[model samples]
Target: MKIAILGTRGIPNYYGGFEQFAEFFSVYLAEKGHDVYCYNSHNHKYQEKTFHGVNLIHKHDPEYKFGTFGQFIYDFNCIMDSRKRNFDIILQLGYTSNSVWFFLMPKKSINIINMDGLEWKRSKYSKPVQQFLKLAEWLAAKSGDYLVSDSLGIKKFLLEKYKKESTYIAYGAYPFNSPNEDILKEYQVEKENFNMIMARFEPENNLDMVLEGVALNSEDKTPILVVGNHNTKYGEYLKNKFKPHENIRFMGGIYNLQHLNNLRYYSKLYFHGHSVGGTNPSLLEAMASQALIAAHNNDFNKGVLKENAFYFSNPTEVKNLLNNSKKSNNLPFIKNNYEAIVNEFNWTKINGDYLQLFEQCMERYKAGKSK
Candidate 1:
C-alpha cells in the first residue's frame, strides 16, 4: 500500500504527539513493506530525504513568518502535492488547520482523518475562533472516507454530536525499565525525591492549577519539577506567579527522551493536567514508566487510567492529594498501569491495528467503486 501521512511537523519528531505518532507509525508501516511518505516542513532541521526507511517530502511551511495562518498554506501545499502522488491512502493526523482543504484532496486516495480532541472547546480560543473550529470539525467529518478516534470517549462524542462513527484507536507507549541515575545528578535532583508535571503550559492543560497546588505545599522538602517549553506567554505568567516558591522547579523543555523517561521513572509522583486530549503521549509515557499518576479528572483521562490512578479537578484537590500522597500506596496502581501499557497501548499492537484498518479502508473503497 502507498500511504501518505499529513498534518504534522513531520518525522524525526522534535515536536509533540502527532509528530511522534508520524515517526513511529510511518517507520512501522515501512518496515511491514508498505510504501510510506511523510510530509515535512521546509523549516525542519532534519534535511534528509529519507528517515528510517520512510520517504520524507519537504514542503514550504510559512508558519515561522506568517504565524498561525501559515499552517493553512502549508497544508494546502501538502494536499496539492499529494494529489499528484496517487497514494492509496492519506492519513491526516488532525484537522484544525487543514480541514478547509478537504475538497482539494485527491479523489484516488482514501482519506482517513484522525479527529483529535474537541479543539473548539479549548479555552485559549475566542468565541469566534471556537465557532470556526466547529465548522472545521464538521467539514473534516463530512469529507473524510473514514474517521479515527484516539479515545473511546471521543468516539462516543462524534456519534452523539455529529452522528459520525469512527474507529477507536488510542495512542501507544513503550515501557521504561532502565533508568540512568546519573541523569538525575545532571538535573541536581535525587531519585524519587521529586514530584513532576510535564506538559505544554496552556490554559486547557491546567498548568496554573498544578503550580498553585505545588506552591501551597512548598514546605515539603521534595521539589515539584515542571518540564516543558516555558517561553510562551502562559508559561511566563505561571513562572512569575510561582516565582516565590523554591520547591517548584521549572525545567524548561528537555527533549532527551532517555533522560525524560528516567525522570518519570524515578519521580515520586507524575501530574498529568491535560483536560482536552485523548490518550496524551506524555500521560502514556508516565504510565509506561510506572510513575504514580495524579491526572486531571475527565472522561479522556479516566478512559485511559480507569480506576488505577489518582484524579484531581482543581488546585484544592491537587493539594489534598499531595498532602495525603505516599509512594507505597500508589505502587499497585503504578504496576497496573505499566501492565496496561504492555497489554493495550504498546506500539506493536497499535501499529498492527493501523495496518488492519488501512486494509479494511482499501477493501471498502474498492467495493463502493464496484457498486
Candidate 2:
C-alpha cells in the first residue's frame, strides 16, 4: 500500500516523541514491502533523502514560527501533496484535528490520526489558543476515519469529552545495550553513585520541583544530573535558578542515543517528574536502562510502572528519598521491570501494532465511514 505520514517535526527523530514514533514505524512498514513516505520540514535539512528504506518528502512552511498557523500550512501542503500522489492512506500524527479538509477532497484514501495527548489542556498556551485547540480536537476525532491514542488515559479523555472510541497503542522504547565502563565515567556517574533525570524543561514536566529537591539535599551523597535543553525562556529561568547550585549539574539537550543510554545505564536511580501526559519515552528508556525507578505520583505514572516504581509528589518526599538511609531496595523490581518493558516496548513489536492499525483504518475507509 502507498501510505503517507504527515505532521511531525522530521524523521531522523532528533527532537520529540512523535518524530521518533514516525521514524521507527515508517522504517518497519518499509521493511515489510509497504511504500511509506513521511513529510519533512525544510528546517529538518531532510532535503528529499531516503532514511531507513522510507521516502522522506520535504515541504517548507513559511509561516511555521507562528505556532498554530505554521502547523496549518504544513498540514495543508501535506494534504495537497498526498492527494496529488494518490496515497492509499494519509496518517497525520499530532496535526490539527480540523484536517478533514484534506480527506474531503481526496479520493479513495483513509484518514488516520494519532491523538498525542490533551494538547488543548496544556498550561503553556493562552486561553483563546487552548479553546481553539479544543475545537480542533473535537473536529479531528469527528471527521477522521480512524483514531489512535498513545495511552489509556487519553482514551478515557476522548470518550468522556467527545464520546469517541480510539484504539490504544502506547509509545515504545528500544533496548539500551549497556555501554562500556569509560562511557559511564565520562558522565561522572558511577553505577550506584548518582541519580539521573532527563526530560524537556517544561512546566508540565516539573523540572523546577526536581531542581529544588536536589538543591535541598546539598550534602547528600547522590549527585543529581538533570539533562534537557535550557534554550527557551522557561528553560533559561530554571538554569538561572539552579546554575549556582553545586550538587546539581544541568546538562543541556542531549542528541546522541548512545551517550544518553550510557548515562541512563550507569545511574543508581531514574527520576521522572512529568505531571502531565502518559507513558513518556524517556521514562520507558529509564526502565529499559535497568535503573531503579522513581517517578511522580499520579495515575499516569502508576499505570505505567505499577508496583515496580517509586513516586514523589513534592520536594519534601524527593529530599527524604535522598537523605534517608534506605539503600534503594527496588533493585529486583527494577530488573523485572526492565524485562517487561523490553518485551512490550521493543520497536519491532510496537511498529507491528502501528502497521496493523493502519490496515484497520484502510478496512474502515473501504466500509465508507470516511466521515
Candidate 3:
C-alpha cells in the first residue's frame, strides 16, 4: 500500500511522540514492502535527504512557533504534493490541518488520523486557543476516514464528546539493551539511587507538582533529576523555581539515545507527572528500561499502566510514598512491571497494530464508505 504520514514536526523524533510514531511506522512499513512517505519540515536540524528506505518529503514551514498558521502551510504543501504523487492512504497526526478536509471533497483516499491527545485540554493554551483547538479537533474527527486515538482515555473522550468510534493504539518506545557501567557513571547516577522525570515542562504535565513533592521530601538523600528542554518560559520558570532545592537537578534535554538510556537505566524510580495525553513515550521508555514506575495518580495513568505502577495524586501523597520504608525502589512489584513492559511495549508489535489499522481503513475506502 502507498501510505503517507502527515501533520508531524518531522522525522528522527527530535521533538516529541508523534515524530517517534512517524519514524517507527516509516521504517516498519518499508520493511513490510509498503511504500511509506513522511512529511518533514525543512527547518529541522535533523532534516534528512532520505531515511529508512522510505520516501521523505520536506514541507517548507515559514512560521517558527508552529501553531494554526504553520499547520495550514504544512497541510497545503503536503496535500498538493500528495495529489501529484498519489497515495493509497494518508495518515494525519495533528488537528490544525483543515486543508486536508477541504481537499477530501474530490478524492476518496483512505484518510486515517492518529489523534495523539486532546490539545484543547492542555493547561498551556488560553481560553480562546482552547476553544479554537476544540473546533479543530471536531473538524479533524469528522474529516478523517478513520480516527485513531493513542490511548483508551482519548478514545473514551472521542466517544463521549463526538459519539464517534476511534481505534486505540498507544505509542511505543525504542528498546535499548543493557547500559554499561561507564555509561551510568557518565550521567552521575548509580542504579536505583536517583529518581528520573523526563517530560516537556508544561502546566498540564504538573512539573511544579513534581518539584513540590521533591521539596517536601527534601529530607531524603535520593535526588530527582528532571530531564527536558528548558528553553520555553514555562521551562525557565520551572528551572528557576526548582533549581534552588538541593534534592532536584534540572538537567536540560539530552538528545543522544545512549545518554538518555544511561539516565533511564540508572534511575531508581521514574516519575511521570503528565495528567493529560496518552501513554507518554518517555514513561514507556523508562518502563522498558526496567525502572520502577511512579506516576500522577489519575484514571488516564491507571488505564495506561493498569495498576502496575505506584501512584501519587498530590504532593503529600508523593512525599508520604517517598518516606515509606516499605516502598523499596527495586521491589519485586516494580521488577515485574518492567518485565511486563519489556514484553508489551516493543516497537515491532506497536507498529504492527498501526499497520493493521491502516489496512482496515484501506479496505473501508475500497468499499466506497470513506465519506
Candidate 4:
C-alpha cells in the first residue's frame, strides 16, 4: 500500500505527540513493506530525504514567519503536493489547519482522518476561533473517507455529536523499567525524592490548577518538578505565583526521551492534568515508566487508567492526595497501568491495527467504485 501521512511537523519527532505517532507508525508501515511517505516542514532541522525505510517529503511551512495563519498555508501546500503523489491512502493526523482544503485532496486517494481531541472545546481559543474549529470539524467529517478516534470517549463524541461512526484506536507506549539514577544527579534531584508534571504550559492542560495543588501541599520536603515549554505568559504567571513555594521547580522543556523517562520512572508521583485529548502520549509514557499517577478526573484519563490511577477534580483534591500520600500502597494500581500498556497500548499492535484499517478502507473504496 502507498500511504502518505500528513498533519504533523514530521518524523524524527522534534515536536509533540502527532510527530511521535508519525515516526513510529511510518517506520512500522515501511518495515511491513508499505511505501510510507511522511511530510516534513521546511524549517525542521532534519534535512534527510528518508528516515529508516520511510520516504520523507519537505514542504514550505510559513508558521515561523506568519504565526497562526501560516499553519493553513502550510497545510494547503502539503495537500497540493499530495495531489500529485497518486497515493493509495492519505492519513491526516489532525484537521485543525487542513480541513478547509479537503476539497483539494486527490480524488484518487482514500482520505482517512484521525479526528484528534476536541480542539473547539479547548479553553485557549477565543469564542470565534472555537466556532471556526467546530466548522472545521464538520468539514473534515463530511470530506474524509473514514474517521479514527484515539479514545473510546472521543469515538462516542463523534457518534453522538456528528452522527458519524469512527474507529477506536488508542495510542501506544513502551514500558520503561531501567532508570539511570545518574540522570537525576544532573537535575540535582534524587530518585523518588521528587514529584513531576510534564506537559505543555497551556490553559486547557490545567497546569495552573496542578501548580496550585503542588503549592498547597508544599509541607513535604520533596520537590515538585514541572517540565514543559514554560516561556509563555501563563507559564510566567504560574512561576511568579508558585515561586514563594521553593519546593516547586520549573524545569523548562526537556526533549531527551531517555532523560525524561528517567525523571518519570524515579518520581514519587506524576501528575497528568490534561482534560482534553484521547489517550495522551505523556500519560501513556508515565504509565510505561511505572509512575504512580494523579490524573485530572475526566473520561479520557479514566478510560485509559480505569481503576489503576488516583483521580483528582480540583486543586484541593490534588493537595489532599499529596498530604495523604499512600501511593506506595497502590502498587497493584501501578502494575495494572503497566500491564494495560503492554496489553492494549503496544506499538506493534497499534501499527498492525493501522495497517488493517487501511486495508479495510481500500476494500470498501474498491467495492463502492464497482457499485
Cα lDDT tens digits, model 1, 126-152, are 899999999999999989889999998
Ranking by lDDT: 1, 4, 2, 3
- Compared with the true structure, what per-residue lDDT tens digits does model 4 show for residues 90-113? 999999999999889999999999
Model 2 pairs whose backbones collide: 97-140
The digit string of per-residue lDDT tens for model 2 on 5-29 reads: 8878779886688898888888888
**lDDT of residue 116 for candidate 1:** 89
Per-model TM-score on C-alpha atoms:
0.96, 0.91, 0.91, 0.97
lDDT of 3: 0.77
Judging by lDDT against the true structure, name the best candidate. Answer: 1
Better of 2 and 4 by TM-score: 4
Model 3 RMSD in Å is 2.7
**Pairs in steric clash, model 3:** none
**By the lDDT metric, which is better: model 3 or model 4?**
4
lDDT of 1 at 208: 90
**How many steric overlaps does candidate 2 have?**
1
Off by over 4 Å in 3: 45-49, 65-68, 98-106, 325-330, 369-371
* Local accuracy by lDDT, each model: 0.91, 0.77, 0.77, 0.91
- Per-residue lDDT of 27-130 in model 3, one digit per residue for the tens? 89999999888988878777666788778888887657766577777677777777776788888886765434555422746777777777888978889988
